[model samples]
Target: MSDLQVGLISLGVVLILVVLVFNWWQDRRMRGRMREHFPETDRDPLMGDVTPAPGRREPGLHLAPASGDLPAEDAVDVDPNCEAVIDVTFAQPVPSDRLHAATQALRAVGSKAVRLFAKNDNGDHRAILREGESYASVQLAVLLANRSGPLTDIEWSQLWTMAQNLAERFDGSVEGPEQARVMARASQLDALCAGLDAQVGLALRLGGTRPVADVTRQVKDAGFMLHDGQLAWLSEAGMPRFVLLYDGVQVRDVQSDGVDRIDLLLDVPNSPADSQAFSRMASVGRDLA
Candidate 1:
């Protein structure tokens, strides 16, 4: 054989050996890490006994415990009656009384996922409450927290916890924590009666009489760009109609009877708007309805 040919063969042999050694070393490192985090799972068939898949990059992928293993924190002693603290707040005099009374009313109505708390602040009545798990819930919390009445720390804590839990549960999924709370608050408004003693008007306004506003607020709060306007009937037989707008466009019209049903009228164009007239019409319809 020629001297040049022999030299080329030697170089090829050395390169192949280097690749083999590097792959072996990498496999060993991955297997070591996987073994530290997981004990019961089977090893990948193609990889070494302790190694994960070659290209896996998911965060905490190797850190998962056995599928059914409870978190270690569960082993610690805990109060059976202890509830998760959600939020805290302070409320003023008349609102505090109203909140306390409203809480009693909510209990009487057998409301689920609703709570109310009240306290005296140096002779001023104060209160706080939590409604549910969506946007309506936080809106209610905000309204309660922002009202003219005195509020207490306890109420604020409950509301905050409720919001945080909802966010954690449904944050990235459709209809997240903000939406859940908002929906709940809207339902509460649907249940409100005409002759209710307190400022029912303001509550209805702040809580929103229709789902479109609640949904719109939630979409905005979730960092989504608004695209459509909505108006709807919040009452059965269209007794109480409401309108909702987004980005200067009408999206829905809602009407409902004080009974069991509400209807939503949506304004979706077949194509994007061209003239300003269509935009104006949608806006006017939303405001007027």
Candidate 2:
């Protein structure tokens, strides 16, 4: 071996070692920063020690932690903790076209589905009333959970203003619950969600060499309706009681042929979380299995 060739080889080995050491230092620095910012703990202190007033959120922050350990019920944020639905009733039946326009206006204020219902002879609100049908009376239902954490004065005023506009268009009156009553209801609901196992998730591991198509078929037959990637089960009230999410698992080995695996995740939120919900989810999973 030539001395020049041996020197070149030594330089390459030293350079490789330098690169590895640099990466190690970078990794340690990152770990230190992470520990400083987010300590390893079961309970998160950022959620708050006391629930704030309705519509009050710490400024400059928008996100509310969905699932975590709460020391107490009052520790949860009132705004994001509660969900609500409000209704606006008109004096006379509004034509389908007018209702559509009013819905568009409502959408501008808060971008969410505006449900319209018409009363039957028994005074039961029946959903899916045609926009063209003009009845003696109709109701508009607004969901406050989608846009804001809980009911806020701004949101309530927007809804009230829209109701006024809707009433003016139909030349009718607007009737609904008091704003204070709605806020009180929100607090009650948040407390209930806090007590209940608000969030529960179960994972089904598909380890067999079965095709993804077949796995999906079996899940569908299990009575789960596929929407996007989530297989959802809806309550009688038309709310999603639980959801089965599809997540692909990692294959340890790479061969000429790849293995297919679908992770079936069962996610249940406290919207109506109860023992019954958990029981129903377990039963469904067992049936699917």
Candidate 3:
């Protein structure tokens, strides 16, 4: 072959080898990250061609690097000691004037982990009404763990619902038909959540992948009715169950049609203690009143 022809052939071979090396390195890095985060799962990112996209960022908290430099068939171990614990207090029947007070109160305990609790009109703590802080943490962990791009609404909704359903289906130590009752109540709660006013200032505080805290400081600021007292605590199927307080008296056995969004009441046991508890957060009342 001529000298020019031989040089061209050599150049082509070098280019091919470079491309191959680059691809292999990228795959190794991607797999390393996934295994580090999900050590228990049997899935392999390399097998599925799951490449981390450009500019990937997780919401709420930063994720740690992959578990190790080697490719293992299993996931890495999670550091139990590193996990965070958030303490929340669900204070309710907050009026408008109490909004600032609640904020101030939340500020007093402000760490990234601590969340203040505010109640809805029915008087049951929203966090208690939903799943607990651990469930919320799992949700946060999922978000932080997912190093990919933004999840579509449907994607996020599906995951969120899955976590919730899983929590309901398996109630830790609780057993038997108790699982079914949880599902029914979740269905009912679903209907109630949809009717909540956007202005009510409802928000979730992300702890890991779960929303550990549900704050109603804004609802109190909006001047909605506030109640205190342990009304009714019913965990039945067919409707979203809540603690109910009526006429400043709490009752826990009332069930209502899934409509009327605004007037449906939660029946928790009522008392002067409930009233006093509700009034203490009066700053919320002032904002909404």
Top TM-score hit: 2
Of 2 and 3, the candidate ranking higher by TM-score: 2
Evaluate model 3: give its lDDT. Answer: 0.30
* TM-score per model over all chains: 0.16, 0.36, 0.18
Residues 117-192, candidate 2: write the lDDT tens digits.
5542335343433423454455555444431344456666776787677667767677777888776765566456
Rank the models by lDDT, top first: 2, 1, 3
Candidate 1 total steric clashes: 61
* lDDT, candidate 3, 23-72, per-residue tens: 77866765465345434323332224445456932222221233444232
Query: lDDT of all predictions, in order shown?
Result: 0.33, 0.51, 0.30
| Candidate 2 ranges with C-alpha deviation above 4 Å | 1-92, 107-114, 120-125, 144-148, 197-289
Model 3: how far is 207 from its true place, Å? 30
In model 1, state the lDDT of residue 147. 19
Q: Give the range of the ten consecutive residues with the poorest summed lDDT in model 1.
A: 198-207
The whole-model C-alpha lDDT of candidate 2 against the native structure comes to: 0.51
Worst 10 residues of 2 by lDDT: 57-66
> What is the C-alpha local distance difference test score of candidate 1?
0.33
Candidate 3, superposed: residue stretches over 4 Å from native: 41-189, 193-289
